[model samples]
Target chain A: MSRARNIEALKNILIVVLFLTTILLLYFLWENVTMKTFRLSSILPAGSSHSLRAEDVTRPEEIVFSFGAGGVTADPDVDGRYWELWMNAFQKYCGRGELLAEEISRAQFLQLTDYRAVFCRFAYDLPLESFCQQRGISNRGLNQIACVTEMGYSAGSPESVFLYDGRSGRCYRLVSELPAEGFEEIIRAAEQGEYLVYYGAASLFGAESSAVLPLNYSSTLAETPCGAELGGADDAERKAIAEQFFGADFGFVRRIEESQGSLIYMYGYDQKTLTFAADGSMVYREALNGEAGARRDYFEALQDALDFIENYGGWREEQGRHLQLRVRDAYEIESDRQKGYRFVFGVGLEGVPLYGGDGNLLTVEIYGRQVTAYRRCLPDGDLEKWKEDREKEAFSVVGLLSEGYPAIYEALRGEAPPPVPPEGEEAPQEGAFEWVAARLQNARPGLVRDAEREGSLRPAWVLCVDDCDFFYDLYSGEAFGAVPRQKD
Target chain B: MKKVIMALVLVLTLLCGSCFVCAASDPAVTVVNPQGNSTVYADNILISVKVTATRVLKITVFEEKLLNEDGSLSSLDSLEALGQVTAGSLRHVVVSPAETFYSNGNLSFYTKELKGITPGIYKLRVTTLDENGRTQYLQECYVVVRPPSEAKALSFQSEQSGVLSFLQSFLKNIFGN
Candidate 1:
């Protein structure tokens, strides 16, 4: 009887050992510890081709360095390393910082950024969580905030960073425990640097002046010259870009020239198409024939877009002009009942925008981590002269609109929206500059293709009155072009 | 007591007459743009000024050609005229706050554009007086200018908050509350 019992116990021990071994194997697979060899599929785009990170494409539309007392360095890129240095430092210091005010009133928001600080304004709103993740910032209640349109660090409150939500009009502050070395470096640069200074509209106009947002802007813009950056791109370059899309299967792709002078390269049963237009624009589109897939987050969609652009032709500056793209707009797009996102990027030289065309340099649509559409309209610009001492003339927003109102009024059909008077005040007299003074919804200085002067790029003050955009000569304040605001 | 009261009334009237001769700081007149000492990023500068004055005012911008040909200081006293603004026609209203007091007041807005200027520190002095011909004083402020932004279509940001108040209003012509 004892021998029989011993045999049974041995069997039970073996069974326990086998159960433990099974669990260990399942754990390794679940954690992807052993699947690391297969993880390349997840990181790389389809067909094991292409490389890009979110940081490569994400950039602030413009950076403003406030030196207190209404002194600001907007577009603080004078061919200096300030833009990159400030961007890196702000991210490094504010990541994982504590939240001081989860949300602040508009009054406090304005006050926080009004003083000595470096603020980055984005053309497109960033999902704060995705932003924090991309910047590698983890904790301190940053997740509570939904979106961040602008981020800045105030010298007055050195311990904190302020975030403004342009959409919700909400403000939040994230505090840092350790001293911000990056912020200090920027402060040192602003104090000791020979940067350009612009007065805020608030400083020039009354607080009630609704001329410009953030009220921290100069009405005038520096004038620079630009010519075609990619006007000389030949068929060889276009073919090379197309090859990047089809990879080693270029010979297998069917090429067709459209009646509109655009050459289309179709890959296998219309799975994808690449078009090279006579105007030197290239577009790559994917057929979205699959069923609606689960929508991915904005970060994933953005990453896919970045990877797609990087793989096709490239996103870096073409020619010597540093043609980088910055996010201008993002929206939920649907096709055939399939949900996805469309990201529009404004092309610029050395991080500044190129203001003509469809107002977008690149547009990409992504669904379920797959990019379905990509468009690249590289500027045909010669920016070498602009790289020189570019500030020639400037006109204040009032100056631009004062002389520009008649044309502006006529261009926009004499219905330019006037600034609403403060409550308890009578409406402004229907005549006089009441039509334009301090009523500018926006005033931006940027590079535009001079329609009058062919093959030349001239600086302009792109003023937005109501939803209509009026491009005026930065020096003369003469109307350049006007168009209705493109809906996001 | 009656004689003393009569003498005080006579003194008050005299003081009131003196005040009208010069509006002084009350109902102040201030310069709006090119806040003094401010720097310009561009080689060309426009001495733009936005002034909202209660009385008729003269806006003059003097470019202190502080820099010589060698780019050194030129004794800071040379006031080279950059631009000036004077309106020929302006509307005004007569207001009576206390009995027997009628003042011609106007809330007029004036702005002047600056001319071509290179990178240099300019001490611009602005002199203005109401119809009373009040004496002027000096106030310091700074403002700067930079290149045009017509490069790329900029993403628009049209709402922020409070503005920098009346850029360096050298003399405040406080008309009303």
Candidate 2:
């Protein structure tokens, strides 16, 4: 009787297994019959990668508006609402531009961007070829300067367009016969928007200076929800990105877990090894296995890098934040694989740029015809919505330094303040602030992500002084931290 | 009752701050802060004024003492005027009494910064001159100062409808802000 009972149980288990197999088979058959174009391999990211245009990759870092006499304003919008409208309209005029001047006088260039003008600034030099392609203009003799660091259009002088090359500090001019009604409309809208137009840097110190001190101590700045981070992510949660990277090959990819919660995934014969570090950074390194296919120019190489970025993970636009890759720099580098260019990018939210601890969103190395390396360091989710908050006060360059004054004054001066009246005195004066402000190479507002805090981001003013980068809270004017300035 | 009255006055002042219009019609000069005899705790004050005189030629901005030492609020104005912010050329981020300021053409904006003042009621004066060298318009806003540590609230209460903004900035001041 016992044997019979055991046999019955075994028979029941087999029947259940058979039913499961049949259901799976039926589902597969149904899928095949209903969706002929669908295949398991089609789900791979490389098969239908994200597609983007050259114009989408290279964008201005800031849209600086000179309102009145030395009243410059950079308005940070929640969504990149109308920046593209201005940029696209500005590009339409560049196509018909005729070479006006190779080298514009310093006074002339400053005059163009000084008042009633719109200056589109790039964090790094924009390749002339890429810029031309982006605007759909022929590269032609536009190579007078290898790169365009900044460009502008003065409503006051609609007949002429200004181009700035940061490398040479030389300005170029382009003349167009087209009407500048588009730019005028954009400018009029921004002007009428009632932006907080502060006294410009030129008003505080001198012309063509980036250092700015608030002329009015009681003035206020706005605070925006910059960026966000994910916390308490488990190993499986972090490995999810690795799976997307491997795509069709994810099943076969060898995943090696490292100490301190690091994850490494090696794809087929060491072709590519991706690392997800504990610091929420992801790096993709392609092994130098294939033969040198073909050498290409920077433009073609950039396209390839963009293609790879889309295939693996898009600019996170699908997430609805309109996140785009704003290229900060392009450098000629030689790796063991081959000599190629490295494109460094910072993630841009709408039009505003959010810089990380290292201020790098992504770095891709294109060797010959292939992308040899790629690095990504951002919060877990690209399109994260920080809690909605109203605008807060922004810290001025002078105010920010004042928060850490005297303490940093000694470091800034490399000595104590001279004794006034009696001995044992180390009192800094306005002159000390003036001294530091003069040395400030540049100051701009953006969001800062603290790497150690797992993506805790805050709105801050990023300042470069004496080869160092300092971040101050946008509202409280408190110092977040400072790191060595990364030379482009 | 005294604390409640002070709170109520502060609330009213902040609500009406953005559109504070006191001067005459010709130039329409409006003061932004230190309304008459308002109390504040800050190291420096900005003589920000809005003028409607389109034909203004020159504008001179400065500050003057409104109260003598040993005044009621003067004792509370114990903050060191010559702060590092002035010394380092850095400006401190001071919460404005007004919640929201909309700019059209009447906004003259921030014109001058006055630093290193001893605690007392001080007057921020803006003298606007027309095409001629003569003074065309003048704006004066009086503010009382106290030590930063003596302040009771993170910021003044506003009647403006920006409740989210008020809560955001206030929470920022008290929290990990």
Candidate 3:
């Protein structure tokens, strides 16, 4: 009986062991499946708007822009006689067009209306609908031209400024926010009685005359005066156009103010802004509440954003003339239990991305499947005109590995300085091929400019080394700048 | 007869002691920093995990998609790849074998300075193994990543209890044994 009881006890232990072994085997299988699924999702797209397929991603084209034009670096040839007449007309409107000649010569005086009409002839190129005013700066009364071209003083594009030449007691104040490159050359030319007429693209280092038009004349010559022919839509028409762009026009009506030739329809109460130019260009901005709803999945938010842009952004899929907008990156925001995604879209001209000096472009914010904010500054120009065919020489990637990158890595690692050995010890040396295996991450073509200084947008090879950026200018073939990576 | 009874009592005592060890000394995995349901303010989060295993440890961070019944993660998707490190990379605590039972220790991972991490929920999954090719512990914790300015200081813990502890508590509750 004792032997039989022992056998029964041993059999019970065997059964328990088998049951536990099966459970353990099943647990492991489930664990592996869960891990595999996690890995697969990372490589896959987050969904429609937040995720991008390999084919859908745009590979930006690389191009280099030359700096100098006609052997002069960003300098324009000025037509002194036309400028003299234009300034005189401007001064006459300010009650001094003919009086300037008393300080110089009477034959040089020109009629204000005739000059305005002539300047308005290139209204498409410059802002010319400005009203003249006299303002005292530094105790000297100067002729102030508020809006001199097609640009608005407030926004849309970078403020396009015409050269301001004002007289302060026998001294001339050549006022320019963007002083052209080779200002010394311009001053020497002006002293010789030759005026420089600047025309073409803005330079990185202020104004360099790309084309020169010398006015070889002794006096301010006045010809036939052309009439001001620009016209704009009424309040109702403006409201209708704004509604078409915004899809939902719900803001309180406010006064329409005209500045720098462009009519801006300001919608108060909600801070919605709508700007329009009778020349068929416009800019619109709207703000929405971002903290009130459950968030949508990635694709849903992306589709909503793209649909909003296509309907109201004045950018059409078929119209190749508008700036081609592409997704630069997407950031997910979770704060205060409020979740959202901010998508930054880059403006591409032809195949090259256009970098605004202010890092300005289109940015859309989506919260809870709805777009909460939209902001963009679409400049009006033929984008194709700026496209370059020949790629210029840029600093080689191999060179970046050895030269600019080592310093950046040292800063990240916090390597200690070598201890001094005796009074005149030699410093320790790094291995010849030390950084050879240090790979660069997230390399791509980006349009970047110096935010602190005035500069034109240029193509740069933006790469991540220790999560910080190293911008290599394609034109200058040098290390442009480094931006420390923003922390979460 | 008295000797036989004594031998029987000794064998029974040995069996009960072995059962106690089986019930109490199992491995456990847990997230230390950014406790479950807590909001992470810093962009580069310092991730710390505690493990009680003798062999290799694999820690993974996944952008969680769904929530399970116990208010934990049900599914996961990878957003960024933070490569693997050794389980013993960082020494955490010094406890005796009798007190810890398993190799109770901690491992920390520092994330790269990420640019625009969408504010959302994420899951950190940790798996550990024993020396004899046996699974030790597998557990996950959920966290919220957000900007510092918008974060709320609220913390709650929801971890998978060790199997031995669960059984102990269950027996104590049911039988008061």
Candidate 4:
């Protein structure tokens, strides 16, 4: 009886163990399936990529306005004619051309006497007595003297006169210091229109305003020469526009008036800010707030932002404004923590884009259907005249490369020689370089003013190389300034 | 039958407890210390991250600039390359499961206070691949590295007070006045 009972008990135990094992197996299979489904649902959508339609679209032509030319004459002036004579005389004196053998032309002698400053190439051999007798000017025996500019001499002190030896092409400063009395006399003579000829090394070479010397120039000298104030919307006007455009629901708009002649508008709620400049440039920004439905598909987001910019962002059509903007670049961006799309509009006048002043003419940030930020810095001024003037002084690519490259290379490498392409690499031709539509011409044209004179505004061309912008004078082709890319 | 019933109940309980134990060992990634808004106030910032995975993990910290003067989302003035690795090479993958896999491991990053780093928002990311060929990235965490000058001032104040206290204690012990 005990053995039979024990055998039955063992069978019962075996059945219970099998039932538990089966249940565990079912649980494992169910867990695996559920986990797999969860993982798949999470991975598949993220793994698949979508294309942005804005990326496929071609960039539209930018409207470029012509900024007026500088103090260069269409026809050579008297100064220009003399500058040519000096160049010829120097070349002949240095034996690069047929030697004039120290002989002065009757016409050249008279022109020399009219110069407020006189620099003799070989001062010692100058036929000063005869020249002075003819001009009825009292004389000093002029000899192999250096750079002497009668007009620029007062500003460039008489002691600072540089003399270039024609044979060796070496420059030498004549006087360590000029007697204050003598310097004063020279200035008085210059002011009185009397020909003051100083025969030291100071007066050999005449400085041409438009001709830049071989490779000696500073890029820092070029500046937009404080732009003219084209009237801007005041605090009241800005406030009303901000309210009407961004919506009054942005709550309260506070104006932080310009400390440096620029204005800013700060909104209380939604953290929106708008900056308006005296030159009619405006920058607007706002927070994205929520992550939920605020996201839109890439192409949809671009279209929505485009619409917002056209309607509210100062890019709308207006008669006689001549101002237009087109999308130059659009891209889906994943930068730092912010993942969104950005559209850069090339601001143009008529059909040409005005290039200069902090790179982006106008940029719109679109996270989804929401336009999170808008920035426009289009210059507002006499657009028609500026455009017409720029057309006359438009820079050639060849001129920019020839005149601007040396200065740019020197600024980057210091004294080191610039790099040349390797043997098989296609050498960059003078005009072969690319033209990227740029904002902010790196350099502005400004007249070199004396203490009593206000300089004229000169038109400038900004040339970009390896992301560095070099501003060249439209008239002289001298690189007056350089600025690194904003992106850098 | 009575003994068999008792034995079955005991077996079932053991099996259920075993399942709980196995589930407890499932893979996870966790930041162990300085878990939230860690400030650098000393000679260095020490970050301890705990990770549980079936394979090697790629951990990197990146700095993000939140706003610019123009109020744009992207500022070119901000430095772009700020990624730092506390452990493992950029593309390192351990071959053997025995060496690579870990139930949990503490990886400490002693960043020497990240000198010369601009104070801003930063993020920590952990990523790994599972046996199912799925790439899994854990939730990114944000950390703010406070200005070093501010941290240094605080440290200097604390040190000054500590020195004064020590001096006062010494005086008391010597004179008892």
Q: What's the TM-score of each model vs. the native? A: 0.59, 0.58, 0.31, 0.33
> Per-residue lDDT of A85-116 in model 2, one digit per residue for the tens?
76677567755544323456655666554446
Per-residue C-alpha lDDT of model 4 across residues A65-141, encoded as one tens digit per residue: 10011000111111223333333332222322111112222223222222223332211111223323333333221
The top-ranked prediction according to TM-score is 1
TM-scores (chain A) of the candidates: 0.70, 0.72, 0.38, 0.42
Per-prediction interface RMSD?
17.8, 23.7, 33.7, 34.5
Tens digit of per-residue lDDT, candidate 1, span A1-488: 99999999999999999999989787565533443222333335653543455665566666677655444556625354666786677667755544333455655555544556787776657877776666676644454456787887776566667788765667766555556668757756766866555544444544323233322233323444443334465555555556667777887999898798778899988888987766555778888867537778787788777776655655444335466556667767787777888887766665445665334457788888667877776565435566444334465555555455656666555565554344335555453344444445556776766645653556667776655667877666667677553432
Calculate DockQ per candidate and list them. Answer: 0.07, 0.02, 0.00, 0.00
Model 4 chain A scores worst on lDDT over the 10 consecutive residues at: A63-72
Q: Give the Å shift of residue A323 in candidate 3.
A: 6.2
| Candidate 1 residue-pair clash tally | 48
Candidate 4 residue spans exceeding 4 A from truth: A1-57, A60-230, A268-270, A292-299, A335-338, A387-396, A406-460, A467-469, A480-488, B1-177
On lDDT, the candidate that comes out on top is 2
Alpha-carbon runs more than 4 Å astray in model 1: A1-52, A78-98, A175-185, A207-278, A316-321, A335-338, A380-391, A395-397, A405-444, A464-469, A482-488, B1-57, B60-177
lDDT of 4 at A237: 49
Q: Worst lDDT window (10 residues) for model 1 chain B?
A: B77-86
Error of 3 at A199 (Å): 43
Of 2 and 4, the candidate ranking higher by TM-score: 2
